[model samples]
Target chain A: MLYELWILAISSLVAATCGIVGTFLVLRRIAMVADAISHTVLLGIVGAFLVSQTLEGPLMLIGAAVVGLATTYFIQVLDNAGVPADAAIGVVFTSLFSVGVILVSLYARDVHLDVDHVLMGDISFAPFHTIEWNGIPMGPQAFWVILAVFIIDLALILLLYKEFKITSFDPALAAALGIPVTLIHYLLMTMVSITAVASFDAVGAILVVALLIVPPATAYLLTEKLSRMIIVSALTGVAAAVTGYYTAKYFNVSIAGCIASAAGALFLIAFLFSPSQGILLRGRQRKKAAAPASS
Target chain B: MQEWLQFLSSPNLQWVMAGAALLGLASGVVGSFVLLRKESLVGDAMAHAALPGICLGFLVFGRETLALMGGAALTGLLAVYAIRAVHSQSKIKQDAAIGIVLSVFFGFGIVLLTMITNGSYSQSSGIDEFIFGQAASLVGADVQILIASALVLLILSFLFFKELKLLIFDPLFAGGIGLPIRFLNALLSSMVVLVVITGIQTVGVILMAALLITPAVTARYWTDRLGVMAVLSGLIGGLSGAVGALLSSTISGLPTGPVIVVTATAFFLISFLFAPQRGILFRMMETRKNTQFVLNNFLLDTMYEKLEKRYAAGQYSALFSRRELEEQTRLPRNGLEKTIQALQKQGLLTQTDGKYVLTGTGLAYAYDSSLLRRIQDIHLTHEAELGSWKEASANGDLRKPRDYLMNERIHSLLTAEQKLPVSLAIKQSSIEYADQA
Candidate 1:
């Protein structure tokens, strides 16, 4: 039960961190780029391993930042060279990810990295890897790492709320107003990279994508204001984390995968039933709008 | 190389390579349309979405390949619909919709996969094979399916080539021309789904998109014509498949899907850097030559203008020293030096006692350059009247301004606007008088 609580805490922190950062990505309409970053950060982990022989240091975050930025850089290169946006994203991420996969198979054989763990992470073991200071046991290492990430993300988002809001809504206006649109974009990307890597040990790379995109997307359907949306997105992520934990426990399935599925389920509910933007309500409004004309 | 050739000669190896090649060919052909339609990542979303369906099929029907493929197709099509629904039904954009559907469905699929792994199903072990594909496990029946799918894809693409071409390039025109745009779009999406279903066995879901995008994009660098691009894309995809299959088979412990993706990306990188006309290397060289040409023209124009000013001021000794030329052109010293050396090598500049003057041929060339500049000035000043010329100039053939001046309509328009240069105006009247005689 204690382990289950630890897993739930870690997963919620992971989801909340992803939720806050992913809000910016969805607003900028670069959710696919986030997906690409999620995939290619595997290469970062492998690279960090190759460099430092471990995946448990600040080197992992640094590697993820470098590779995540490189993924966007390569995509920009292809875009400037006349490749369409989707094809540029598809090609860059896949190629880099394939290289990562090949490297893992070749050099990281002694390590405990496998494709399965990379796809669907094992959060149940989060309790076992506890952090120690002065012979006293702290919480799980993943919990602390993700908590630090969550705090940093929330603080940054709070500090730069106006900058993020202005840049995301109208980049041209932001540039005209001297808001440093490109810098804000890269800053957001860095935060996303850090959050993704921090959540990776608990939720895996792919489910991190789910937690990143699905919660913000669900919140997007619920609210129109950026501040409310961030709050709603984080809340939705926490909700999914809690519910998904129990669901996974009952079914004896992957906790991270179940959390992602739970996030998706929440999105479906919000999509079909949100007061301002639900599909059923919109369809009814459309019918009412058409009735007078038909009559 | 000898060992590779011997390995290729083995019958089993040949069969697997052929199967992979066919899969690659089909994906490449269909992927061309998908890439041109800007739906390259839809194949990726469909591939991920097919996982749960495959698991559901295995749960229900045990291990029939046809049933599994059917299940994959159903969910794949469902994912497309879901993406469309999310995009159109709300304020969420297409990219977010695709990401949401892709990751969520894959997450759900992982849940099912974990269930099957932990379940008491006897044949659950092989189900994981669909995740990271094992090309070595492919048998003759799978190869036969690949062959048939490849044939069907080729034949349909051939039949629909004209409509697909029109649809991708100009959907509005195609719709105005009464083509069934919706049906054609559905046909293309269905073709993508078919490719994903057939390909998941060889390349898996995660990297399946690379097979669809890399070859198509690589082929795009080498061709502008759609028909040629599609054919080239198919051939490149086939080659990547055959090569990747061979390498993975020979390489012990290497996964086939990533190996195949690496092979396709290798082709993409090669094409990106070195293909002619559109390749990065060729573009860099072309840009360099253009810079040189622009510098050359600027130097000649500046020299001609300065010499004209001196002649007008009645200074016959109008030769320019290198320092004066550099100060006048305002170009950087090294570029100025290079341009001067090139002009001298071309015999367009003659040096006398550390001073430079244009040769007779160089004088004529400079005169034409000035005349072209005058015409451009007139065009810009009288842009409203010269709107048609804007389109013509956009073709970038301004090497001979005299040809445009000779056009009676342009000449009369320029004269009416009083925008013609004095020299060209007199020359035009003389030519008109000569034609009258």
Candidate 2:
């Protein structure tokens, strides 16, 4: 029982890792794009499989991440060249997914990726498919890969500190400084893709989207600073994952559904009560802003 | 062809096609303005929100028949009105309001559905197709409803054309001019709801948004004029519906709605590539043409004037060095070098005299259309007006409404004692309006 709980703990940590990266994604209003990336990563999976016969963790992660980044980069590049962001996203992802579907049909007799499996994770089955090195369990590959990606995200933030801030906050100013705003966009997008694909094995594709978006969005409702938002989102995500997993176990219901619902609940809490960015709360703020001062 | 003819003539398929065409035409016409308003995806949310309406309808009527469907449609219209109310009365954003309405309404619908299933009323149909989209279930009455709805929307749109344009493009100006912008705004939102409900029997919600958006977006690439955009969008949409209907009939397992969406996407790709003004092929050809003209002039005036010699790289290279070349004269450096290389390939200029002499073909291309430059600029600005309009609208500027509206209001309300003008002028977002896009 303790071991099962530990496994759940590791899974939540992975969720937290996804949430940390997701904060910026929601902040830049690229949450739907994150959803599109999750749907479109099948192309990268097929590409990876064509190159390497196995679904060995690192190979799949890198392949998916690269494709994810490329997708985001092209979308932004087209948007910059006068295409609206949503239209560009719609164009790129649907076209790529069509190609992916064609390839998936042409290459394999039976499609390996199940849509149901992609929508929801099977935690009971997750424990069975384990890998180890010599003596240590290395926890689960889901946990470690997400952690490594999280670390890489932190490193990228550290190195390109000023550029990410400027680009995310004010692209015009960033462009004025001659910082390759486009390059930073691609870099951040690549990280998003990597994080998406990394935890994908544990929590299917669509739920990964729900995870990536909901926590960061909830965090957005709570705070403003980059670092603080990241931390808050991660913590919130981890808490939700734990509560959600146990709730699923208790109810004998859908793990993904529970997690998504819990994250949605967190969003509602913030929506109802958050000081500045909440929906109803923001209306109050607006009313206050518009009010004349008392003498 | 015979089988397809028979199929097209068949009543069921006829119902499907009519449903598709009506939904397509209405969405095309209404969606053009919706896309212009950037409320494209609000349809998608309303589609989902219509679930509670469906559930409620089913609850009252005891099935998924026409009356229940009407109830669902009413719910969708009300949701759209609510969206307008929230956006107008409050500071909630369009997208966020959509998200809020989508989840809450859908969540309630789900709960209602769960309760219905729990009770004796589990005989619901069309819910499956309602989530994605199902174009196969349209019967005769459904077809009639779609056609009537489309006709109503078209009639209303024509009657309210000038008012709709003003409200969509310059709400502030319309408001200032004492035109019931709120009523017109509600009217447009209601039209979108009408489009979605008409679509529910055909496209459903998830892909319905794409249908509403994609044709309008594709049409946007082709024309600056809103009327042309509306007509073109309707054409694209109708064609896609026809194709989707035909293809889905041929294929056994394919769903009607997705196939229709895919077909629309095909039209979009075609527009992106083949549209005369903003297309990929046109842009590329224009760029090539511009370069060729400058090269031809450079060859005729610069290299050709020099001597009867195979021009060498060094001498005519001066013609290539200038950064800004006139449209008819010497080309810019990059284009000049490319042309010189082509000329060299044709044995015209290859370091024979240290100058780039144009090939006869290259020179001919340059001289072929000296007047093309002015033509090209006209196309470029006109081709991308959607972005320009979006930016301009976001800029919130108005140049010609204060006098017209204020005086109209003063005259109408004070002198005429018009209650409508005073009541209509009670909006805060109406700061001003600029000229047309």
Candidate 3:
């Protein structure tokens, strides 16, 4: 039972961090870049592990952050060089991910890093890898990693709230006001990279994309204000994390997959039933508009 | 080399290679249209969306390849439509809608896959290979399906070549000319779906978009003509596919899908750096040459002006020391020497007693100011015309006067309450403006 709670706490923390960072991603219309970063960060982790010979080192996060920034930088370079944005993203991330997969298969075959686990993380076993200090158990290692990432993300968002807002909303105006728009953009991508790496072991790389994009998108539908969107998205992420955990336990399926599915389900609910932007509400509004004309 | 020949001679390897090549050709052809339409990632969304369809086909119709392909095609088309519908109906933009549909459909597919694996389906064990693709597992019948589908896609694309080109380059113009644009769009989208479905088995759903867009983008660097780009893209795709297959066969445990994608990326990198006109090397060369030309022109014109000033002051000899020339041109010492050497080689300058003097040819070239003045006059007139046109358009002076009367009539037809609020807001704002004045 305690194990179950730790899993829930880790998953919720991962989801919430993804939600907070993903709010800006969605607003900036680069949510797909988050998808790209999640995929390529695998290369960074595998490379880091190969060099450091340890999975529990800080090098993994640093390497993943570097690769993540490299992905964004390459995508930008390609875009500036006349390749379309989507094609650039498609090319860079797919190639990096392929390199990572090949590396895992070739060099790291004896290591714990398998392609399957990279694709679909095993959250159930996360609690067994506990973190200890001074011979006292703190919590699951995954939990602490995500807790640190969550705090960093929260602090960054708070400290740079105004810069992030202006840069995301209108980069040109922000640039005119000397806000270092490009620096802010890279900083956001760096945070995304860190969040993706922290959540990767728990949710896997592919589903981490789902965690990063889905809840924030659902929150976007539910609210009009950015602050409310952030809060709602974080809440939605936590709710999905808890519900998906229980659902997966009941069904004996993959926990990360279930959490992603639950996030999608929440998005569907918001899509269909959100009071202001819901499909049903729009349909009713259309019907009401046509009623007077019909008479 | 002998081992490679033996491996190539194997019938199963040949079949896999053939299937991969054909898949590449079809996707490359369809991908050109996708790239031109700026819908490159739509292929990715469709690929992810096809997962549930694959599972559904397995659950309902067993593990027949044709049944699975049909199911995947159906869902792929559904996903495209869903993306369109979501963005069109809601406030969601296209990218967000794509993200939504991709994750949701993929997540749902995972759910179905897990359910099937847990259920009593004996053939469900190897279905997970579809996630990363296991081209080695493809049998003879699968090869035949790939060949037939690829051929059909190629034939259909060739038949509608002009129409596709028009749709890609200028859809609004195509619509203006009374073409069946909506049908053409639907046809092209379905063709993309067809290519994606056929290619997914060899490259997997995750990397199928790479096979679709990479070769096409790489080919774009080598040519400007669409026809040439399409053929080159297809050839590059086919080559990457064959190479990837051969390498995967030679190496143990290297997945064919990622190998193929990496091979295509390799091709892209080579083209990006090495192609003649559009490649990075050539672009850099062109920029260097342009900068050299500008610098040379500025230096020569500066020398000419300085000589002219001396001539106007009654000094006929257009001679100046290297230091004086450098001061006049503001060029660094080495640059001044190089420019003077280049000018001397071109018979535009001469060195007499350590002083640079303009030759007759250089003097004549410098005196040719009429060409520059004419170019400046044309530019000035063009700017004036543009300015007048913008003012005229802004003031509505070029519009039909009757259009304004019609607009005013429509405005008057609104209810008094409707007009009152708008007029009141205008009045309030104008009153504030008056107070500020």
Best by TM-score: 1
lDDT of 1 by residue, A156-245 (tens): 888989999999999999999999987888888888888888888898998899999999999999999898888899999999999999
DockQ scores of all models, one per candidate: 0.84, 0.13, 0.55
Tell me model 1's lDDT, rounded to 2 decimals: 0.87
Residue B254 of model 3, lDDT score: 84
- For B168-253, candidate 2 gives per-residue lDDT tens digits of 79989999999997688778877887788768767755456766777888889989988898988888888778788777777665
**Model with the higher DockQ, candidate 2 or 3:** 3
lDDT of each: 0.87, 0.65, 0.83
Candidate order, lDDT descending: 1, 3, 2
Q: After superposition, how far is residue B290 of candidate 1 from its true place, in Å?
A: 1.4
Docking class of 2: incorrect
Which DockQ value does candidate 2 get? 0.13
Candidate 3 DockQ category? medium
- The local distance difference test score of model 3 is 0.83
Task: Point out the higher-scoring one by lDDT: 2 or 3.
Answer: 3
Q: Can you write out model 3's per-residue Cα lDDT over A1-295, one digit (the tens) per residue?
A: 8998899899999999999999999999998898889889999998898889888768999999999999999999889888999899899988999999888888888988987787778888899988789999897888989899999999999999999989988999999999999899999999999999999889888888888888988899899998999999999999999998899889877788788889988987888888888899878988999999999
State in Å the error of residue B12, model 2. 4.4
